[model samples]
Target: MYLTIPVLVLLVDLSFEKEYLSWKLLTTKVVFGQAVQLRCHLPKQNCCHNYTRSWRGGPDYTLLTLNEKSSNYTKYIEYLDTESRTSVLTIKSFSESEVDIIYQCSYGFSSYEAILQLTRHRYEFHPTESVPVSLSFNGTHMYAKISLEKVFPKPQCYGNTNEKDITKESLKVISKRNGIFYKSMIDFNYMIDPQHCFGLVTITCTVGTSRITIAEQNTSCRKNGSTFHGKHLAQRDSVASNSHDEESNIVGKVLIVLCFHFFNGL
Candidate 1:
């Protein structure tokens, strides 16, 4: 008797919903001279089908970029395919003033929005100008010191206008070692929050006619339950030491090979 095996057939159900824009609503912080890009991805091909995309400014509907128009500002928008299913909006250059406006990406019936925030200030220097600044850190604290040769009755901290407003009182003076100078010290207490996972700290210094600003970021690694310190000297020293040891080991291996070859030849 001959027996045949029956093939089992299975029906699979596959259905996809229209794509929606998923993006963070937080503002982006960028340097004055650098460029920034705002991106958005459609949920699925069905949502992008027969749909038009455009960029607008707030409720005023000020058109920044449109699929139909091509100009200097709109040049950043690139159409990827014949269906126009994928697109990217890029800012080739950024300035301090652009931080005040809000940028929005809209597709058919859905939209995503973001604002630009400048967290640091741009410094322009002249041939005769000088900026005095120093940074120091202890195990638990960080300190910034500044000295200005000239004195001003109304010294102001100048930086990105989009940042929070800073007052004159925030500038604290430590001491004046010499009669023809002035000094200021800023004390920063360091703390880690595992729950928040990430944090950003910005420091700004202003003197009689010069101003400077710095930023530091901290992030936590969940797998190891440790914080990533971008500014810690100890971490930097360890990294340097490891690199040096690796190089030394590599050199020792090369030297051993060379000595073996030399003795064999002799």
Candidate 2:
């Protein structure tokens, strides 16, 4: 028998183009031990001239220039030059059991945040399951939405607004939802205490044993306070083709190999 594992294709375009600077973000859902490429492109039209670019880690961290200690980030970070129109950062392969990582790009005085999440393919042959999720934020209080894509059996979703970790009772059921690319999205306006949460503000969405988090926001009390307001987002028209299904088949074979270890007690 064959197992049909749904794939979620998110066109995450945190890649922005403005009068000063612009960047291109990675949209592919990356697997373990795979190098990911990200680019910061500067168009000659309205971009700031001679703007120095640097990469930083986490929702809260000084410029990468201050790092004297060695970590995973240093091993993965590549070169950046102001003379070139584009700066490429090629992240080295990550371990399957490794935790999720966030990367921030800064140019001049503007900063953009993006997080890279790790995923595991759950086989239906087993009694357990997993939910595929994507987490993102707009910095603004508006459009602070959490997307629960590629959920099997239409799993129930609960959201909680917390600092660091989610609380048990804060996760309220998210009812207002829409479907996209053969998947589902849940949108809500859960308020955030800007001053209290600060760089630690987060929203955790729970679906059974799986959960996704929205973090590294630069919210403050002076700007929007605790009012998290946002309009509903529409679904995308472009549907994924047969290529993704073929990719699933490749992942299935890898899953079989992983399961073999469990049975053999490796």
Candidate 3:
């Protein structure tokens, strides 16, 4: 007896782009050495005939089909339902070179493009250490400032002394290049009556697991009060939470290998 194997092909309607079609590629701040998954689909359309569904991008013009796993760190999966079809692209381990680049998913003759961007501290092109921390005083209040550029996720800033909480505000500027510009400031009145204490003002911002900190010690305060130390201020402003208006844009660049190999006899 002879056995036959069926090739699992995706039956995509060429007209899937019409009448409530939804196709998008998305991901969060892709950290180096972490896994990332991007989902793509066209809503409200189902076909009975198998067409071509593939992904095009990465090093060596990666062309991946449904259920295919690339030699690199990429893989593709496809799903079908009664009303729509879904395709997902997953990178086993995201890297720095893959940041800020375009990847495409093609169904039949239609395709959509998407780009993945790194958080502030992950992009080697614009190192996070390049930004400087600022500290100053106005004779009445001690002020500390921390600024970061190309930050994708919203940042939380804190100003603290003696490990106690203080007043701090954060701001994020909208931009289209890599991410957003984040700046935070902390203010403390060191001239309280009957007690004057000032020692260290530490400024810090955290986005996901990445954090940046700045501290200035021995600030001018009366020598009679308790010394203020550095601590993360648990505070965020409305500006930082609402500054992301647009997604990062992708440009064609060097190849970061992503291959799609379809499962045989599907």
| Candidate 3 worst ten-residue window by lDDT | 247-256
Which has the higher lDDT value, candidate number 1 or candidate number 3? 3
Kindly list the per-residue Cα lDDT of model 3 for residues 123-220, writing each as its tens digit: 32222454435566665555443434444455555556657555333222223344333333333233323364656666555655566664444565
Q: What digit string (tens of lDDT, one per residue) describes model 2 on residues 109-205?
A: 5556655543333210111214233334454342334444443323444443433434343343333322211134545443444555444344444
Instruction: Write one digit per residue (lDDT tens) for candidate 1, span 1-266.
Output: 12322222111111122235643322254333445555656556555546777766533437767773534553344343435344565655544345546777767666777664432232211112244233344433334444443332223342121243323323344434332223333443333233442223345555324555532323223432333454466789999999999999999999999999999999
lDDT of 2: 0.45
Candidates by TM-score, descending order: 3, 1, 2
Candidates in order have lDDT scores of: 0.46, 0.45, 0.48
lDDT of 3 at 172: 28
For model 1, the run of ten residues with the poorest summed lDDT: 7-16
Candidate 3 — which residues are off by over 4 angstroms? 1-22, 28-33, 43-49, 59-61, 64-66, 74-84, 114-158, 162-201, 206-266
Models 1 onward score TM values of: 0.34, 0.29, 0.42
N/CA/C clash count, model 1: 0
- RMSD to the hidden true structure, all candidates: 29.3, 35.9, 34.7
lDDT of 3: 0.48
